[model samples]
Target: MLPNYFNTKPLADYMRHDLNIPADREAGSLSAGRVGRIAALAAASSAAYAATGHLLALLALLPAPAPAEEGDEDRRTFWTDLRRASGASALLPANLRIGVVAALDGHGAGLATRLLGAFGGMSTDQRVATALLVGEHLTNGDDFPGPASTTGELWLRDVELTAWQIIHHHRRPPTRQAREQFREAWNRL
Candidate 1:
């Protein structure tokens, strides 16, 4: 359990107000239920991957509806909705998180990256909370059964690259070049 002094309100407010999560969502609440769920999801996803060695199968637990055609707008909508519904539960092990985001349509993937970027300036507690939320969202169970799509694999590569950017932003003091590059990428998206 987190220390009593580890405040989560700022992070929850950012997710709800800045990231645009619905005010009604439990993720936006200050209650321990939300934090507990985030921690539980992270621990569970980590344990599952350690035990099974099948990240793909674990990611498959999340709902990823296939597009009739690649890059379909409806599919993008599905991913966006999925992100909203799952909240910060989408951040899992690197392999699983990358797979889930890569499976999204371009717009959806862009949104995911944007959300990660938002974590760049937050406090450590907030970042931890955000990571937990994202991990849980992606690892949360669904009934869908199938391998990740070819497009998803290809997009996974891209997400991996962007995720590194997020890590750089979070782990170190920002550099001008890194900030500029991040802006350029966000603009392109």
Candidate 2:
């Protein structure tokens, strides 16, 4: 369980309003799909690597799509809607991945704590994941901490200027090549 301070309205509201997830998502044993996918991917890669990837996905996507599995079962609604909404192809995944990566970089946990409050109630990985995904910004580009920058862009800014140079900034879509590129770009960043 999180401390009372972490139970603030803003954080809870972000989960409910933005992610549409229960604030207790981390406190639970984790959803079967979230756990199974992370376990399998971790087994394939290293626990550190797979765990990191999973956390970032939790942070960025709208409803936080489960990682792409073999059958593409998890990829259906989230990715499809994102593609249709964003008009991206395979590059969507790449941008999201890069956006998350750039957002985290060295400031991973620190950034998450600042945006999410009290870090991850029980899960430390999410301390960074939520930051990379949802991110913080000056609301209306205000640059002040009060209201503006509430919707701030973290990795979005860095990645756009540096890697890929996406003009409109695409994010969402799951292709093997995009996965590889996302990983590669993350490494380069």
Candidate 3:
């Protein structure tokens, strides 16, 4: 069984406190606002991923729809309605997306912690999975922590950018190649 405190706090706590360098930014380090945003984004993304996974599983049980013919307006309308029903939003600005990714690249654990918080509470297994996914996707392989330059930040920035891109792309009917790429990227983490 998990501890009560662990279940109540967002998963991001693990990453921020234990993973990130300086962990809690002091006066000269990163600002409170930046850290807070990263934490919040991470938490939100994690929750969304979990919820979406459940939703897709339920959807899979239903009968498959017929393939749309070329330029089928009805197909387009159906997707439009479906997306509207899903209610996912494009929340992060592009610049911030880049910055967060950069942070993840340099500090995978820190990034994962922020994301774990965003994901909210989960089983120990779930938390670990979420952390691994975020860390792998965001940083690729980079994992050094220190003062962040724009160059260094850009490397990590790809993770956030990829997340956003995935969310947006998933809304549409992805091609086989696209789906394969997405799965491969995710499986790597």
Candidate 4:
């Protein structure tokens, strides 16, 4: 059976309020403005992670940046807004206890890691949620303009895979390879 937390309303409400999104914007509406789109995606991503502890649903919500933009600036803005919204929501006092995860990309992963790590007093669930968020963010290629380096991509894949194993596979521990790769990726960041 699905978990009750999968309801998504609370997550949507949290995003809308914390991100200062417009009241009329609906979380499920694709026609909304940029802020609304980001809010919707963040809410959906958070709910999907909390519900299934998997990254696919969250990844699928990412729309490719519109091609009409002249350069990478538009893509950068999209990722930046997404990272900002997710970071804000993740750090909220009320939402912190929900074990929220953010779907970050690129250097945003490093930023989220440092921010969450500095908290220093997070509960075990919070730590797990942060790790899962990092994994989900790293696994998403949409954040990158071009293909990521093979080694970096592989490391991210392992991180997400290990996180899933721990979250949904009866507490199976991360493999030695995954641990090593995660350390390497963290250091590179």
How do the predictions measure up, each by TM-score? 0.21, 0.23, 0.19, 0.21
* Candidate 2 ranges with C-alpha deviation above 4 Å: 1-61, 70-75, 106-189
Task: Name the candidate, 1 or 3, with the larger TM-score value.
Answer: 1
Candidate ordering by TM-score (highest first): 2, 1, 4, 3
User: Considering TM-score, which of the candidate structures 2 and 3 is the better prediction for this target?
Assistant: 2
Backbone atom clashes (below 3 Å) for every candidate = 14, 12, 16, 0
**Candidate 3 lDDT, 1-189, residue by residue in tens:** 111122212334444543454344464565777667666645654543443333333223222333456565644454343323322111112212442343323312333333323334344454344334333333443553433333223432443443343344224234456768999999999
- Which ten residues in a row are the worst by lDDT in model 4? 103-112
> Could you say which candidate leads in TM-score?
2
Q: Each candidate's lDDT (Cα)?
A: 0.40, 0.38, 0.38, 0.42
Of candidate 3, the 10-residue stretch with the lowest lDDT total is 1-10
What is the C-alpha lDDT profile of model 1 across 1-189, one tens digit per residue? 111122233333444443454445765565676566556534533321222222233334334555446666654554555344334334322223443443231112333354445334455555444334434444344522233333333333344454544333223234446778999999998
Model 4 lDDT tens row, 7-98: 34434454555555555566465345756656565654553334343332333333334344457664545544444434444333233223
| Model 2 residue 95 lDDT score | 40
lDDT of 1: 0.40
The residue-level lDDT of candidate 4 at 106 comes to: 10
Local error of candidate 2 at 114, Å? 22
